[model samples]
Target: MQRLLVALLAAFDAAIAAAVGLVVLLAPLTLLWTLAFGITADWGALWPLTGTLWEFGHGVPLAVTIPDELLVALAIPAQAASFAVSITPLAFLLFTLLFAARSGARAAAAGTWLLGVLSGTVVFTAISTAVALTARLDAAQTPLLLAIVLPAAVYFVGALCGAVRVAWEEGDGGILDRLHDRLDVHEDWAPVPAAVVRGAAFALVGVVGTAALALAVMTLFRGGEVVALFQASRVDALGATVMTLAQLVYLPTLIVWAASWLAGPGFAVGVGTAVSPAGTQLGVVPGVPVFGLLPENSSMWMLIVVLVPIAAGAFAGWAVRSRLVWEGTPLGTAQRAVIAVGIAVVTAGVGGIAAVLANGSMGPGRLSEVGPAALPFMLALGLEVLVGAAILLLSPRHRDELAEERTDRWIAEMSELEPSQAPVVPVPGIPLPRAHDQAFDDTAPLDDVRGFRPPTGNRD
Candidate 1:
């Protein structure tokens, strides 16, 4: 009965999540439509546009074809009439991922994570299928299969990841428990998986934090340039508002680009453009206000920014090592090395995924090849992180660390000892002469006490 309840709740949660995403899109687009078209608006197109965009936001690529009339009116080139837009605005995707994770965590807490996750995924899949079937945009079309699968896959993956994390930590009394028992047999190796994941999480947070900081600094210094671009665009208040909102949605994507730049691979604005700390090369780039944040030039010395990611990795290693010491599970050198490698791999994998979602076409022609190349960015970041993690993880233990370990061991030993088994200090034996065994009467004590030495020395 409880399991069934959990599944029902999970399905409800999934439905709410899907509705919320659609509403967010629908709200803004509705206002724009009403303002532009007034009473004569083609209200039928609203749902389709919102659904298609929601799908696209979840990483489904859209084939955008300009209408013949609009193309002719705008004098657009025939070659640029249609193009694919695959670079996703990560904000919506992140929202869904986080929400699903929360739901999965709740399910795990309810003691039936598998059922909950499956229920949530099934509901989400149904919604995606309905959207694909009903939301048909003649101008911007998505693959029917991809439209159905991508969003569902995103939710499933997120839910699975969240459930597994909770189950592993809290013991699900099932598969995770069995796996944990197996690991317990090899005490030295048991912590490797958790430590690696922890370290990787730390490293990713550090890298993202640094990227955000860098972006902030750029915005501060280049605020005027961004404003100038906004002015040059000559957009009215509503258009500017929409543009600003669009850019905000892409902030995470921009942060990924910044991280890639810090990693040394940089990214591209066009076919032959490069935006890296090492240098900058460009020709006829788009005049988007966000693009104004790009550096017009860079010195070779700027390449030192690569150290930021390495430092992040080193911090991760330190964190994991500290945890090991605290838990009294000091691993061997080989195990630690594996941990370092694992941290790097995880960080690289995450970075690569971000790169994939952040890179692709924004428009036609030269704009198609935008953002970082995933392979180069991943390899560079992984190698750099590996170097940093190895420095901390594989290094010899310090004197302080050894002392801490000894202290922990002592505490453990003391805690394990029973009261009866506790050691007692022995007192040394001292010999004493037996007292006189006589019972002299109190009445005759003054004259004949045992061995009486009466007033001999001090009497005079």
Candidate 2:
């Protein structure tokens, strides 16, 4: 088991290394495109620096370069610090996934893998989006960045997830056993409702925390002075910052939500809905007519739609609590899938409508045209919600299986005990007689045995 775990971990590490390598290799191509296109006519010299940083950081750098004009530098150290902080969640996720998988947590393993992939995609999109937004950055650079970053991120994330999974499954005391103890209500009772509630709460907290963190980061880093500096220098610092910050915030939320889902269904939905409000808003596109009369803000409509699904999922979970007998058996696959899709649709519609409304309200053409990068992020979020919900709902069955296994183990251990194996009482300086030998010596007479023999042959 230890060997298997080591092998799995090694594999995961290799995959992550390959991903990093791939991203590094693709940096030069993007640099070439930037040089050719004259995107930032004045900031061309900075591309080399940006490329160097990108290569060094595994495509996780914080520098903005215009097409061919000028460059404005931000606190690179600060950005890098934040980036490192943000990546910690990804590392945690990778570790958790490999552990869960190796420990035989099928549902959790699946959920983690999905989340890791989604995170990678989000990161890749953020990088590409940053490049695309840079007016001075070559258009060709966008594709090149995507080509390199996406695969690298995915491979690394996948490898980490796979390794953790192997370790978890093969390691002593599986996660399932631990989860069973945590969720166990009684010998015969299943703690489905409790698990769901806990899971949902964790997810919600994680999502809200992530969003707040993103906002805080943006507020701290996206100052008017910084924006102006980049703008004056004809560098796309603000846009790059926005993209990077979004990725940083979103990645952690994915891991948190995934972990929570494994712990409970309600939590997964709550987190999924909370973290994915932006996507939900987008899904409510056009807008939902409130009261069939007044047209509400798309954001408002999106909120309503997203809330409805969450509420429905919660209610469903509650209803089936008593019926669920095992961990991972509370909600069926179809039901979970429905809820996930519903949540995604609601989130996307609302987010889209809200974005459109906000843009329209701000004035026409206020927000510049950007690629559909946010769309994939939203879609990934929605999918996460669904997957998480399913995992939570199904957890009861897994829990029950673990409980039974534990019980069986306990019984097996007890069965090994024998009365004959009881500790013997030693008589000092005297040899113990065998029970059979004593029985055969009955010829000494039962009456004579009425008087007890003193150990020292002294009458007392």
Candidate 3:
């Protein structure tokens, strides 16, 4: 496990990842386009498309400029049409994440995770630089710095996560593990970690569940429209398959949009569109099948759906409260409140990040602006969960209730362990006696210690 060898393997892993992702994107596309459109352009021309998609998947924006000649054919008087396309499918990112994680975990086990992550990032940055420099397609432009930095960022995050995960579990004695040990010493900070972690999980589940339910309802109500749009595409099974697969890749992004919707901010498919319960106001949307799920015109009653995020927050708060109640000792009410808010803050930060990733341009013009506002979504979501959690955590726990819980827990533990005493005896006429009770005589004659004579033998 030499540092140099670890670095090399990490780079090799990244290279293989990129190669496989490109192949997956290009192979099916090549076959489908050739069959469907007779490959009007040379096979080499498709490389730029693949390259552009690669950059897109890394969350890089593409500047598209239309040629002047097309304007005349389309009877348009616009001088020069230029717009940015920023819709990232996330499939490439997901693939790289998994690959880099594997590489980093292996490197961490070898005690060279730093070198491994650095090497992979360096290679990825270099590859991205080359692609940005040479992969322009038909007047399309890639941001030079973003192209170099974005993919490397993704790789760095993935590698760091993987390395830390393994390092944490295996006790690699690395700086990360050392810092973790140091942090674990702070009693004041102990409850924060559990509350934050559990709260985040709870919020994630709640928000995602809300989205799923909404999506299901949409599918049921607007099933015909979705089907009609699919039929209108007039594509053969192969084309439909490709389209379906592409949509599947953006599923997580859609879920994020749904979360935004549930949070009351809603999301836009295009610039002027706002699909919220406040009432849907939309223009002509693109022919994406998922767009068919939009309600024609939402009623004012629909605005009540904002409760979804509030409910999600409450769920998260409840989770944090439960964890603190079970695992925590007596703390000041202020401290408990602080712990609950801390969890909300962490979850809000995560939500904001998701909003940022989910919100981006789909294509030129109106389609460019889409998805939720990050700051607003975070604040709204955080406040909701925080309110519910604070109410529960800061409330006084009755001593009786606490005692009952402890007693129940103790009984459960006792039931689980092997008993040290003999087995209980079962009597036909009476209830089975416990081993402890069997050792004592309940009906024995007692001697008086107050000088009064007690019968040595039973009167019976």
Clash totals for all models, in order? 0, 69, 1
Give the TM-score ranking, best first.
Answer: 1, 3, 2
Instruction: Indicate the residue-level lDDT of 279 in model 2.
Output: 30
Summarize candidate 2's per-residue lDDT along 362-405 as a digit string, tens digits.
00121122112234434544444445455445445566655866
**TM-score of the candidate numbered 2?**
0.29
| Every model's TM-score | 0.91, 0.29, 0.78
Better of 1 and 3 by lDDT: 1
Better of 1 and 3 by TM-score: 1
- Where model 1 places Cα greater than 4 Å from the true spot, the runs are 418-421, 425-460
State candidate 1's TM-score: 0.91
Candidate with top lDDT is 1
Please provide, for model 3 over 1-460, each residue's C-alpha lDDT reduced to its tens digit, 9 standing for 90 to 100: 4888889999998788777877887887788778777847477767878787788887887887778888778765473377777767666777888888988899899987888888987887787777777777876778888877888788888888788778766767678777767767976665565566677678778888889787888789998998888898898898788778888877777777788878777878787788887878999888878788887787888778777766776777766666555663445676677777886787788888778877887766688888887888888778876776676667778786488678867777768765544345543334444556655633322342234464588676
lDDT of 2: 0.38
Once fitted onto the true fold, the runs of candidate 2 whose alpha carbons sit more than 4 angstroms away are 1-5, 8-12, 15-21, 24-171, 174-303, 308-312, 315-460
Cand. 3 Cα-lDDT: 0.76
lDDT of 1 by residue, 287-332 (tens): 8999999999999999999999999999999999999998888889
